[model samples]
Target chain A: MHEGSITSQIVENVLREAEKRKAKRVLEVHLEIGKLMFLNPEQVHFWYQMLTKNTILEGSQLLIEEKPGTVKCPKCGYEGDFQYVDDPALHMPMPTLNCPKCDGTVKIVSGKDCFIKTVKMLI
Target chain B: MKINDVVKAEEGEIFDIELDENILKANAELAQQNRELLRKQGVKAIDVMGSIGAGKTSLIEKMVQKLKTHYRIAVFKGDLTTTIDAEIIGKHGVNVVAINTGKECHLDANLVQKALRRLDLEATDLLFIENVGNLICPAEFPLGSEKRIVVISVTEGPYMVVKHPFIFMDADVAVINKIDLAEAMGVDIAKLQNDVKKINPKTKTVTTNCRTGKGVDQVIAALNL
Candidate 1:
């Protein structure tokens, strides 16, 4: 359901951009989803197909790229990627945020963003 | 000239447009607005998040019981499709707003902003937003609260802390509720607290039994309310 709302925002942005450029058709939409966002790309794509109907993005292709979760430790000065546990049966994976070097608490530096990076259109 | 030899070419251009905008930017901006508005109104807001049966409602009820006399309190209850929690809190004779998110798993900032608009902020000193019961989705969404609290009970199992560290990372305070049943469940109470401290050392950890009101005072002191 979160993906549905997010897809709506993406659609709105794409349509507004297309309208500004007077594009004949939207070809592709490039998105970057952070690992920590817990968003399922397949779900977003499924919702995009349904939400874009009759809009300028009706036939546009959606391409989603996942950004890995990165964290930096303030106490140990350790910076690295966090490990995510993926169970075959679970819908979402659990991310581990412990610092790899000192096992201290780390602050997330990346993998929280859900953004539209670019849009390809035929004008 | 032959008709076949007079063919013309069709021309088309492909253009790429960059839009480096976050899908959740709108929600974040609205959340900032809510935070600023709450600050201006002299209201302290807390976002309480946890899984189902984690004593979120019970802890809130206890907090309201303890703090209601000193400060005017208001609550915004968020659920997928029920007003049951709100009804329970409403019986305490305080302001309660029930927000049904339908199929959404978590409450967003926009929803909280609407609830804030409905409540008379001037009349309230403290506001508690009880987020939908789910550990995963709620951690990612900030509802513009001054402090974020994550409640987890021993009944849910011992692995909850390690399994859901992201929620602990986002929380300012972590409440391990239902400690009275820890011995019967064959689970340790201290190890769980240690797990939380390992993930977020800065997060204030409090053990509570909301039903009996044990350690609830520590929770208040930790929140500095």
Candidate 2:
């Protein structure tokens, strides 16, 4: 529901970029949504269209590219996408999801972010 | 940035700052604004972070009661969904506000700035921010808090210190909750202490059983409140 909270911010930045470049007639707005941010691209799109009206980005297209949630495993020399599933080898009582290599806990390398990475417009 | 005796443990990898440059600037500006407001108001900020169900809320509740009588307190509690933490803590009557993070793993400075609009930092002597309950995300950002406190329970792992050293490294003090279960789970307190020292020798860590109000007094004393 705070989609507006973030969307409004994106629109402002999109306008700032367009203005900095001294461009007119905005075109496509580029966004990079990180997996760790827990934001849905579809929800962003839904709000983007609704929020951009009557502004510099009015009728401008919003293009979003998702960055995966990657983590580095301490035990295994593997760094890639993370999957959370319960597993047993991790510890005592219950099975908890862990690193695929050495059953170690992995830390997210990136992907939890919501930002207007790049914005394209006509001069 | 100056190096502080922390090891990378490996070579650097190529990644990128995926967020918008403008948004990053905006966020930085917001953090500065909150920093000014906090200073102007004399509000002391404490950030609470831990894994899901690690007892962050219980410790906060106890702290609110402990500090409220001597001074006015404001709380900013973060959760992915539902204001249940805020609602529960509100019953204690300490002017607690909830931040529903929607899907974000951590709370950045900009969000804290927005929340500050709703909070009167001047009327309050102390402020506590309960970060989202996951250990992985909250370590990424600082919410302009004067003190950052990381809450960990005994059930998580003895290796928790090694698992999330960043969270603890920034913490002024550490609160280890669920102490009553330490014995039942065969927890090694000494090992946990060693792991914590390895991560951060400066962090003052304390174990607490929030359900029974044990060790909370020590928590207050550590903060000098």
Candidate 3:
């Protein structure tokens, strides 16, 4: 899964920053994940714990902030929240690409980021 | 304090570092480097992605057979464990490299960078990178290809396009393969294409029965190959 790899990258970045600052230990990691990313926060936490074993980030609290999905329709000039396609077969509702107003193709505006916002550590 | 001591301090001078780093940026940078490298060598590379059994290899085979006479082509096929697809493409008298991703569900730019080292880029005019047969993970990773083609067959049912909209949104060309089985499978190609268009009108949709080489030329034309 891409989330596994991405979480590993987050660990690498956090550790790099920690090392640069000469921190004795990491206290917390703050991540702002967008809705469209479809990344499971639990899976990320699991991977983070697995990758940070015996490291400065060990036992650090991970604060995940989920952002909502948003889109901008080009045809009808509609901007804001979009709709999700509900299906009985799917375990979760999928975000629809069609504009909620005009049902035309919409461009993703926000809520696609999986970013590491801040890292709290002891200097 | 001991250097290796486990200090779970409830109160301390907590320093906050605002990194504001995107997790996918590293791979995106590497992909840009790959794009520059391919451009310098005058090579056209296309990344092929789709669900398993979407006939990615077959489409590549047909394209290779038709264009081999005019261009020096190469293929980099990504799979979890086997080189079966690589072997299939190698029989077409073109240089083919198989990339084993181990447990990865998609091919990232870093892996493609390693594969590029094994290929003779200067001698190659066209490169086709067959990503792991996956619809979801591959959409998040870019392998520095000039174009991305996502193939979906009629056998996957009519909802495959809308069910996974992100991949189609990112794709430059959408190949609705297995048209020969459309009638028998009771799948509507028109609706599938419409779904693709509604997601991203910029994406060019082509229907093909890659097994019989039907509509393969249109795919080539769509990619400007």
Query: Top lDDT: which candidate number?
Result: 3
Sorted by lDDT (best first), the order is: 3, 1, 2
Q: For residues B25-77, write the lDDT of model 2, one tens digit per residue.
A: 55556767777789889988888888889898999898888778897888888
TM-score of each: 0.86, 0.61, 0.85
Q: Name every residue pair that clashes in candidate 3.
A: none
lDDT of candidate model 1 versus the reference:
0.88
Score residue B198 of candidate 2 by CA lDDT.
49
lDDT of 3: 0.89
Candidate 2 chain B lDDT trough over 10 residues, lowest sum: B10-19
lDDT of 1 by residue, B90-205 (tens): 99989999999988899999999999989999999999999999998888788889999999999998889877777888888999999989998888999889878766778899
List candidate 3 stretches off by more than 4 Å.
A49-59, A68-111, B1-12
DockQ of 2: 0.09
Better of 1 and 2 by TM-score: 1
The TM-score, computed over Cα atoms with residue i paired to residue i, of candidate 1 is 0.86
lDDT of 2: 0.73
Q: Tell me candidate 2's interface RMSD.
A: 12.1
